[model samples]
Target chain A: MSRDALQESLSAVMDNEADELELRRVLNAFDDAETRDTWSRYQVARAVMHKDLLIPRLDIAAAVSAALADEAVPAKAARGPWRSLGRLAVAASVTVAVLAGVRLYNQDEIAGAELAQQTQQPVMAGPQVKGPAVLAGYKESADTTGPMANGVLQGQSGWQDQRLPGYLRQHAQESALKGTESALPYARAASLENR
Target chain B: MRAIPLLTLLLSGWFALPAHADEAQDWLTRLGRAEQQQSFQGTFVYERNGSFSTHDIWHRVQDGQVRERLLQLDGSAQEVVRLDGRTQCVSGTLVAGLGNSRDAPSRALDPQKLNQFYELAVIGKSRVAGRNAVIVSITPRDQYRYGFELHLDRETALPLKSLLLNDQGQLLERFQFTRLNTSVVPDDRELQPSNDCTPIAVANSKAPEVQSTETWHMEWLPPGFQLTNTSARKDTQTKATVDSLMYEDGLARFSVFLEPISDASVTETRTQLGPTVAVSRRLNTVDGEMMVTVVGEIPIGTAERIALSVRGEKKPAAQP
Candidate 1:
């Protein structure tokens, strides 16, 4: 693109008047020093026009770019049938790491469950493990092993167990009472009280 | 030679974008007016993280007045009745010292205002509640809020199904109608609360003395959010005053509650129940330590940010 055209696109982007193509063009040209300088100049001009205070020398985009440039890139693996196997191994390890992280995070919940088991007190049952029945069949229920399952906070004995439920109920009820959309908020509140 | 087709492709996309947006905007406008003008009753199921429940609704609009009654079909027979957007009664355990922001009028769904924060587009057509429907996708412009996919009935413009999705495009909650009958206006008998539905007390006598002494403000907030209501109510059990602020960006809402905490053992907690997330943080103020809990149908990260940003405006006398 011509210098004038690039400058025009930059100004258009600055004013939030750019179409997709103009935005693309401006972003593509952003690596050029002159483009960056023009963009900063436009920012200064706009700020002056709006009577807004601005540190003219401060350029967050340039600083971010510099920091990003300094960051290390992951080395690419050699291409082979082994690459796919290697990727699978990496994925498996990542999954294991994530599961381990979750288990560690839910220590309190596990402890609570153990306490419940020892006490022989019936813990609130988790959401029924059911197959996807709705449209798109995106699983409707989230992971059930977390701190709260089926709207009942589990394994939590102190402040959260007592205050969190009331706070959640209050928030939902207040939203239901104050909301304009009506049904959704009511459903949310009723869902909370279901337990 | 390839330039012509590319130009045509770009031109088509450029032309098609606004048309889809306009169609979606029209559908939203119809939805905003649907509740006020149309009367419908239906059975809908609400599902969140760990909870799922089905409910029946009876909505009637007569002489510019709207009356709605909802009853949980299963589990505890929780019920609520509203007249002209105001809560008239609620069954089941009511939270003690519920704030009296009854004077704050309910806000209407404003598509124009929503457009500022969410990109609205008519995604496709669908069949819902045995009725033809148009699907509208409302994608948030920022990461701070969740997105929604709404299926509105073609004839009535009422929502037949709604899905809330997070940034990863995971469904957080689903509200879909299984049956709807708009042709029949619900009678007064259908709108009446059952014996278990207790009437909501107005609490008019204590209204004047419930003024909040401390002014709390946020250091940062997600763009487009505006404070809709602020209330101070004494906790019935603890007797500590709880200051609450509710914020909304036309479509989504979240509430922040600040209460003085004397217990040093209490730690910050974060948890999510379905679409709603609760994040509590301890804030040290001039008075003492206050627990700031952010509860909302927003992402946990946003809730945590809000919890951390809460600041009591009261300063020590020495700090000018």
Candidate 2:
């Protein structure tokens, strides 16, 4: 339940128009958007009828949301069922973002950066290198006979000499030719051909 | 004796429980030890972008020293020999300019610092290099790093295959062996580099010089990243010097290359390959029109911001 639904249910109770079942339903979904909107509407209507500007606008839900956003609003939430409500809200938002495309971009660095060595590049040095630049050196080496250009393997590690780069190149090329969905892989393959 | 099979089955199940979800750390630990301890030789394939290659690696550790050699089976005799963990000789066109190999020291694998940016766990199990293997995962803790999953030979702790993944779980690259042999140690002749192998003069070496302060500096950086390496090299074609700097956050790394352009017509360009995104932005440095090209495995938006953030420190402050 969200904060809005609860406030709406409270408004219903004040009007004495809601029965036990309706009250329960309102309480259950009090934090919901629809319920909050209805609650705020009822409050404004009641205030207008009573000719009481004691609480102008009576847009309780918006104020509550702003309070939550600012976090400067008092946490006068009742310690009862609302505790579970907060947990449910957080989990809901996370699930939505995870299920949706709202990924948090905190950790997504370029792939294979771990291969780059980290140096203390103080200001005494020119500019600093950030992240894992593991294979940047090889990018510049993509030439006519470069291992990548030839689409063949190179190295002295007995097995890697025969294999590692082949695997890397195959993944790139296969991804380029096989996928019909997007052009990203094709672009990558083309980049490899850039020499 | 009759109950032994049942007992063994129960014991194995218990052992497997701890490895399932915590694969990232286990995979990294396996990779850290794989090349050092595993004695194996096999053919494997590596692929990225428009290229694919087949090669063989023979790694053996004895008397506390690692001896390894690699050979490209399909192409010319591209070979290398490493006594401990350093490159001895290389037989390839890339290293043709042996007169000036970068003076940076050889980098070592450090599992301790890697964990700061990556979440290590065990994701699943898979077979690789024709051997039973365990899968270990390295997931980035934030958007500043890519992820890797490694399959290690169960018996020897050697990496049989490795996969790089982006934030969306898309595969970027793969390195895996098709066959492997653990019984025999590779001979010295197999570890030898080809005729093209030329020994680098280790005694006479110099780091690339850093150019003037008016070169470049970025005003914006993701939370904890800082500059790490910088060098200036004279461009052969234009005869103008280009300044480059690299930055890293323990795990993630990127490089910013600054080259001055003679004309004002340079355009901003962006490209993406797997998890790597490169963005080049034009900036007016006091010296002239400078092109700041940021190349790394990062989001396109972040790359753009970094490109825009570059400023030359020595450029005189603009008058109001």
C-alpha positional error of residue A163 in candidate 1 after TM-score superposition, expressed in Å = 0.6
**How many Å off is the CA of B175 in candidate 2?**
1.3
lDDT of 2 by residue, B235-261 (tens): 434555656666666545566767777
Residue range B26-119, candidate 1, lDDT tens digits: 9999999999989999899887776678999999999999999999999998899998888888888676656466458788899999988887
Write down the lDDT of every candidate, Cα atoms only. Answer: 0.78, 0.54
Q: Compared with the real two-chain complex, what DockQ does model 2 have?
A: 0.05
Candidate with top DockQ is: 1
TM-score of chain B, per candidate?
A: 0.91, 0.77
- Each candidate structure's TM-score, on Cα atoms with residue i matched to residue i, is 0.70, 0.57
lDDT of 1 by residue, A57-101 (tens): 444455445433333122135367766666565555445445543
| TM-score of the A-chain for all models | 0.38, 0.25
Looking at model 2, residue B62 earns an lDDT score of 82
lDDT of each residue in A119-152, candidate 2, tens digit only:
1112101221342343432332133122323333
For all the predictions, what are the DockQ values?
0.23, 0.05
Candidate 2 TM-score over all chains jointly: 0.57
Off by over 4 Å in 2: A1-195, B1-23, B75-77, B95-107, B202-216, B223-226, B249-252, B315-320
Candidate 2 lDDT: 0.54
